[model samples]
Target: MTVPTEEVAGAGAPEPSAQPWWRSAVVYAVYPTSFADGNGDRIGDLRGLRERLDYIAGLGADAIWLCPWNPSPMADGGYDVSDYCDINPMLGTLEEARALIEDVHAHGMRLIVDLVANHTSNEHPWFRAALAAPVGSPERERYLFRDGRGAHGELPPNAWISAFGDSGWTRVTEPDGTPGQWYFHTFAPEQPDLDWSREQVRADFDAIMRFWFDLGVDGLRVDAAPAMAKEPGLPDYDLTSYGDPTVFRSSVWVDSPQWDTPGIHEIMRRFRSVAREYGEDRMFVAEAVVSSSQRLADYVRPDELNTAFNFQFLKEPWGPGLRDVIDETLRLHAEVGAPPTWCLSSHDEIRLATRLGRTDTTAVHLVDPATAPTDLELASIFHRSGEWVSLASLPGSWA
Candidate 1:
């Protein structure tokens, strides 16, 4: 498990200035709702973001990575987008959104909108159409709908578990008013996973990418990047080996049937090609929780994505030991000629201050993994071949 720092010095890696602006830019991430409030509604909106443009510029941010601002049920903090072409009513109209993007650029900063292509809100028009269309209709092909197993089709089609700790397969009642087929979702039931294998899904996603890139979005922060593609046939697994399915983000890592599958690279390549249409500066950064450093590197190959969040870095203990993570991360990204993005915290992670308080100076520090729930699965990512690392040793290791 020891990483040779000499072989991968300055794991902080290269000077990517010769590349796109986004390569070395200091991106200030904003969870729109709490960033600022406009019009006194107490929820952040595009108008508010525009108003803070100067303030963000003052902080030296080269870009703004805005979390989901599209129409949603707020089921997963706006990640469950019901519509990709418009803004949420609560967030402001499309016109205001355009104004914000303009303002962001005016301040010499780029805008990276969060895109949840992996799944759509159940309320999305396509999903609604899929629901009303017959089980085997063209509409159903847009989603991962399959007939359930067992007598009367009462069981899930597979044994996959959701990231939210439940069965990934949810049975849908037929339009004819009887118990029927199942649809898969990696998160909440409000979100339905898209069938990336289907032509309609791929075509629609390309259009969605164009819709935003045409509006001058510099890049996209791809949510659930490792998902969207699943192992074909959706095979069953012996869940016990991966640990508790109820553990948050801890299940389905090793030989997972739901994520980081072979087909995801092709999907990324397709999306990367779309980003390329907007020129070299228009990039994509993946939020992929993969099993290994090599797998993480694959997300940013020449024809895939531009960059990806080094989430595994957050799992390393503070101080000297943290160098291994930095070296490994920088080494992988360096090998692929892609710059890596690093951060202590993101919208989804626990704040840094709280994580630091749990560790001591001497000996091995028992930080987040020691104090938090056992099912936090970052442990599996660091699991090297023929080595069994304990879940309690990793720091801040959840998805």
Candidate 2:
């Protein structure tokens, strides 16, 4: 998930480059954990990814964005990282990561890894140590922790709920022997949020990026980036009291403190600087869920992400009228004042084929290509085909 603060050289401080490939590229998203298994362990690994490279290329994609493959406890589907540099043992080894990179390049395709910077798993060493320290200790400061006062005499610093389920804050007093404090986790209790307000936390995250970049990754797909900065006042939220706001997409606190906070842009600038340093054409893609065009524009400033994922297309209701999604995309592009990219599917949601009812094979019909019986030979064959046909003038089939 994440690491603690430590002065790391060659991190955010990087030189700028002229251009990067992501500016005009189409990337295919792949969830490696569910793609295919190579070792027969029912878990996808680097070798499996290698096997599927040709298939991905056949789609006319310029690159592929892989979901998290970092060493983890499988708490949140490998989004929880135990080590920044090592590959998860169940997935594969570091050697496999290197080989995958080489193979991807050989096929003339780029690769992007999903970076979950907002939090780390509770089992992470840094979080473990932070949980044990006193309330005001520096280690505890790396995470969001404060003493509780009411409702069991101890509660989290805020009431913001997690994306998965339950309260975002969890009591970390089991191992530590003292009146415990609550730590903030935006997704799951196992994933504790990092204090980006602290300079050390920012620098620590930058170092993690450098580690992967040096390993030859083309770029990153920033996961949950808008949720990086929590509101400082620890204001009580009305939505958190009733139900999880994530599924309905109703609450503003799901992300964005107010809308277009300068802090979020600064964090992205630091990451963009890293891409420039390598002089490698890298794409910085943001996974933002802001509904309005203006809110979406804030994340994709020319100074920030080159391509931000567009969800307006995926949020449409199915019917004969499909222009609403197209109209929304054009409106968002014009109103938001930024270039946008669209995705038809992601691992977190349902497949479009199933959602659109296009998977019903029983409804498909063949069509006849002949018109006015110009050729009796072809017409006789078509008459004898005995197949379901929708139209009589189509190119391939007849009935």
Question: Following a full C-alpha superposition, what root-mean-square deviation does model 1 have from the true structure?
Answer: 9.9
Off by over 4 Å in 1: 1-18, 246-252, 358-399
**Alpha carbon lDDT of each predicted model:** 0.76, 0.65
Which candidate achieves the best TM-score against the true structure?
A: 1
Q: Taking the tens digit of each residue's C-alpha lDDT, what string does model 2 give over 98-132?
A: 88887887777777898888888888888888876
User: What are the models' TM-scores?
Assistant: 0.85, 0.78
| Error of model 2, residue 201, in angstroms | 1.2
Candidate 1 colliding pairs: none
User: Backbone collision count in every prediction?
Assistant: 0, 1
Worst 10 residues of 2 by lDDT: 364-373
Clashing pairs in 2: 1-81
Model 2 RMSD vs true structure: 11.1
